[model samples]
Target: MILIADSGSSKTDWRGIDKDGNVSQFRGVGFNPYYQTPEEMATELNDEFLLKLKEEVVAIYYYGAGCSTPENKKGVATALGNLFGNAKIKIEHDLLAAARATCGHEEGIACILGTGSNSCDYNGDKITDSRPSPGFILGDEGGGTSIGKKFLQDFIHDEMPAVLKEEAADRFQLTAQVIQDNVYRKPFPGRYMASFCRFITEHTSNPYCYLLYYNAFQDFFKKHVTRYSNYDQKKVSFVGSVAFYNSDILRKAAADMQIHVHLILESPIAGLTLYHKDNL
Candidate 1:
């Protein structure tokens, strides 16, 4: 059996393919080697995932956030290796998962716009170039965290339009202290911020909400996508809830920048399952 995982900042999607080519799946809270310790990740995985299949897994292909550096990759690999001692495991950065899922065997620009954001230039088989992802605090321009943080800032500062402001305030029961505590005093603050995107999506018909998404995606194109060589000429694809849910505004932003937007998927797990299935 082979297991493929697409782990983001908020959650992980796991798909297991048996010898007969049958597929089964489950979910778990996300893990990032940059944040969680190896022990913690192992504990969480052991607690959440089905234990019955532990020995059945012959291999694990894990693509995850914060696994870019060698140190990070080793940490994640060690944790998974310990869990499924019989399996051969390969740990890789989530960007490659996005690239494989979106571009497949074709050269293109692949972008991730989930709890956080990243982009890379893929030449059909490998990532030829990529911008440094400084995480949610410093970068993640087009991601859910960035947009939600911006919205919360406006909400806190009384900068949002009155109608939207009132609705958000009432709907979320948000206050300055609550927002601050979630962002500053909590763990996985990026995921907390990204959660607000659901509300934003529900209200996208509102001009203020629409512009918020537009401006965020605009920043993404300027900072990440536009920097790639001949970027506008290449096929651009996106994988993440932010890009998938707000594809209209994302496309509008891309149009303004003369970019051609191609595929958009909520998660790379489905595509990844197929990729590995074919190879296996």
Candidate 2:
């Protein structure tokens, strides 16, 4: 059996395929070497369902966030090795997952717009260029977290329209103290902030909400997409919940920038499943 995983900081989607070509799918908690230890990851994977298939897994392809550095890659590799002792494990950064899932051996620009955002210039099989992703705190333009950050700032400073402000207050009962606690005292603050994206999507008809997403995606294009050589000539594709749910706004932003959007997937798992199946 082959195990393919597309993981973000928030969740992981897993697909298992047996020699007979039958497939199974499951979900698991997200893993990031930056936050969890190898032992912790192993423990998380020790569930009955995962353990039952351990011996059947011949190969494991894990593409995830925080797997960019060698140390981080080793961390996840070690954890997987502990569980699937006989299986070959290949670990890679999530940006490659987006590229593979969206571009599928075609040259294009792939972008991830999830809890965090990233982009890479993919030349068929490998990433040829990429911009620095300073994570969610410093930068992550067009990501849910970034959008939520802007929403919070506007809400707190009374910059949002009065009706939307009242609605936000009524819906979330947010306060400055609550914001500080979530961002500073809680775990996975990026995910916490991204949770508000649902509210933003619900209010897209409002001019304020429309402009918020428009400006955010525009910033993403300027800061990341424009840096690539002749980026306008390449087809742009996206993967992640932010891009999937707000495709209308994303397409508008792309059109405004005169860039063509080729694809937008809520998650890359399905495309990844096909990629792995065909390659195997």
Candidate 3:
């Protein structure tokens, strides 16, 4: 049996394959060394179904956020090691997962736009170049957090249409105090901000909302995608809810910048499952 995990800042999608090629799926809270301790990760993974399959597990492949550095990767490995004591474990950055899932064995530009964002040039098997994604606070231009941040700013400053502002306030019951507390004092503020994206998506027909998404995606391409040499010659693909859900705006943004989009996926877990199953 083998276990493959695709994790982001908000949740993890786990797929297990048995000897007969049968598959089972499970979900767990997300883990990031930057935010959660090894013990906390273990507790999150202590699900009854996961424990039942532990002894049968021969190997574990974990791709996650904040696993770029060796130290951070090892942190997640340690947590997995404690849980699946006899299983061989491999840990890698989530960008690699996006690359493998989107481009497969083909070279291309792969991007992640979820609660946070990142981009890399994949040379079929490994990442050869990348633009730094300073997370939600400083970057993540095309991600959910960034979009939500823009919406909040417009709403709070009364720059948005009066009707839309009233609707948002009524729908979310948002206030300056509530927004500040969640963004400043809460854990995983990126995820909290991203929660507002649903409202933006719901109101995308509004001109203000439409331009907001377009500008954010345009900024993403300008700042990140265009940084790679020969980027125009390679296929570009995206993986994450932001990319999948807002594909119309994303494609428009790409088109405005003369970029060709190859694919967009809501999550990489499905493609990752196929990749691992074929390799096995």
Candidate numbers sorted by TM-score from highest down: 1, 3, 2
- Per-candidate TM equals 0.97, 0.95, 0.97
Q: Which candidate should be chosen as best, given TM-score against the real structure?
A: 1
Give the poorly placed runs of model 2, Cα more than 4 Å off. none
Model 3 Cα lDDT, one tens digit per residue, 92-196: 999999999999999999999988889999999899998887788888899988998888877778899999988988888888777888889988888888888
C-alpha lDDT (0 to 100) for residue 181 of candidate 3 = 87
Off by more than 4 A, model 1: none
Q: Which has the better TM-score: candidate 1, or candidate 2? A: 1
Poorest 10 consecutive residues of model 3 by lDDT? 27-36
Which is the leading candidate under lDDT?
Answer: 1
Candidate 2 vs. true structure, TM-score = 0.95
Better of 1 and 2 by lDDT: 1
In candidate 1, where is summed lDDT lowest over 10 consecutive residues? Answer: 44-53
Off by over 4 Å in 3: none
